[model samples]
Target: MLLETHVLQDTDPDLPALLADGFEVVGESWGAEFVIDGGAESTASLERLRGFVETARAAGLEIRELDARDAAAIESLDAESWVDVPTTPATVHVPVSALDVRDWATRGRRAFGALDGDRLVGLCVGAAGDNDFVVVAPDQRGRGIGGAVVAAWMLGAIEAGERSFSAGGALQNARSLAMIRAVGFRVTERWLSLQRP
Candidate 1:
């Protein structure tokens, strides 16, 4: 799946090479960033995300950083969530393994989840860098869980000295786009996907 696994910049030298190899544009994904210290606009964006977190808490969703114990549940949730999703832009980031989840939990405080009782109902996490990938369970969506987990993760990221945050997804993914925008990120980079037809 290397054909679709990457998002290439508009000026990437590999664009010509891929085209020469019979690859054609199949889809596009956009990259967005939030400048933590950008002043009033930044404050307003952060307020929105913080508000979502408050809403989630009022609804009794517990947002916390993931540890090793959350690995299995998060992995299971990701695998199951993908089963019903119909190939959205974020699908490229799916099928997260337990090992990877553990790595994120054990390394930087990058992975976080929203819990409903003992069940992990939402997740937002990334590697050692910015918290990029996020997913909320199908049944638990629309109640601000996605935004809450992301907000929780970003709060931690900022505490850990992450001055700016980045996120990306398919160009057509309105759900993910809406969530990111609710925070403070702006579309800063866009890249296309090309694959063999």
Candidate 2:
């Protein structure tokens, strides 16, 4: 049997007592995920990310709000994008199927995508409940395309009257964690994963 756990960024200030136990560390246990506060007021970080996305758009990357139920658009979510995100080898990457996206729509969620001409360079979904998931093309990593897609999603959610939002990601995924914070999300909790003998 296999077990997983997570330690959030907030707990980095002081290692929790549980972490000192005989849990074998396992190179950062994996369990819970980071929760983001999307309803956060506009801050310098949010403004900066928005500016970055706009600049990228000016350079020809088009950002558009997507209907999660669109079969063709859901089919466009690239499999390669998921593997491209820099994450610990321990991170589990799941495939997104069109049926999964249809489920997103059933939950009243909206999706967004970034296009470079006719190519789908990035994609994300915003739940009416304020949860979000974002992905960017392999060739487009570190270029703020993911951030752009997420920012666009947030804006659309705001228009739809969503006053609060949150998302989860592995703690080992620093790049993504940075992007989430760059958009004004603060870490709110820490979880520790422990395996039983």
Candidate 3:
């Protein structure tokens, strides 16, 4: 005996449009960056995105990672103290998914926390990738915490067999640029992004 199965097709016009052209609505994502599927969009889409990147670059933004220990302190610092400053939507929050210490530990990535007498004052998260350490955090600003965190992370990365560490900062963010410079991370690339219309 043989059995046949039939799959019902979606009736929504947008569904077909999206599927036929490989377009899909993006969900809310956490972290420093989000990926978009453009499908069959025209050059105009690329142009618009480029314009957005240019504008954001003009606004001064920065991106870099802290040591795992400092990354762990982010939650405590934000919870215990008050920081009076404006944070970019992209820069202020870390995804809960990335904070799974157990998973990171299993994968050989170390998570570290800075302490102020048993209270965590800063945290850092670093991963081994492309022979470099990728760090992420939100509290590495003011009071030289950023540099300290990166220094720790770099040492860990070196011990883990990474020969070099790389990071990025926006042209507009003076504080972040200064912190990265203080830690001796040279500029390697300029990044930009845009949302679809």
Candidate 4:
């Protein structure tokens, strides 16, 4: 298994060293955050990670993962409803173009949407994993949409033989934190970063 962590802009410079030390870069996301995965059982590797995290914190950074679900409704919601909302500066928005829904549908990952009298009010995007659903959506704040979508997503994940789910959010987003907690997710770990120019 790979130990995953999120790194910020100031921490980007340290990524090469971490990679050289055996960490694999999994994904580079928006907001200058990068996800790195590594083996957790090696003591020398772990110590190197400790130093990296401590340094990242000293420069003001954090890392974490979310409770993820794999469900049909998640994908449905995303396709049917999530497209209506405009991405704001305060929110983590994934443009619809970023996803290839036709491909996802064929892979057994279901998409879901929230309807308000035929108008799509919200959407949830999710993919099926071995043990969880990787879900993302725009209807997470004050509405009950987040919980509903997640419940639906979890149902799919469970049926698919996934034991659990995971998701992620930036510490700076209070709304996201509240929504994630409301759906029975707790912080599994903290990640720090050091963004550099």
lDDT, model 1: 0.77
- Where does candidate 2 stray beyond 4 Å? 2-21, 27-50, 68-78, 84-93
TM-score of 3: 0.47
TM-score for every candidate vs. truth?
Answer: 0.82, 0.73, 0.47, 0.48
Question: Residue by residue across 12-130, what tens digits does model 1's lDDT show?
Answer: 98889888888777677778887777688767766877787888989998888887788899888888666544343333664788887767645654778899999999988875446
In candidate 1, position 71 carries an lDDT of 86
Candidate 4, run of 10 with poorest lDDT? 27-36
Between prediction 1 and prediction 3, the one with superior lDDT is: 1
Model 4 residue 93 CA deviation in Å? 5.2
User: How many clashes in each structure?
Assistant: 0, 7, 21, 31
Query: Quick one: best TM-score, which candidate?
Result: 1
Please provide, for model 2 over 40-86, each residue's C-alpha lDDT reduced to its tens digit, 9 standing for 90 to 100.
54454456657866977887898887664454555656576666554
Q: Measured by TM-score, how close is model 1 to the native structure?
A: 0.82
lDDT of each: 0.77, 0.64, 0.41, 0.42
- Mind giving the per-residue lDDT tens digits that candidate 3 earns over 47-130? 443443333234343222334454345544644433432233223434333265435666666544444344454444566522
Candidate 4 C-alpha error for residue 39, in Å: 30
User: Model 3 misses residue 154 by how many Å?
Assistant: 0.9
lDDT of 2: 0.64
CA lDDT of 43 in candidate 2?
51
Worst 10 residues of 1 by lDDT: 82-91
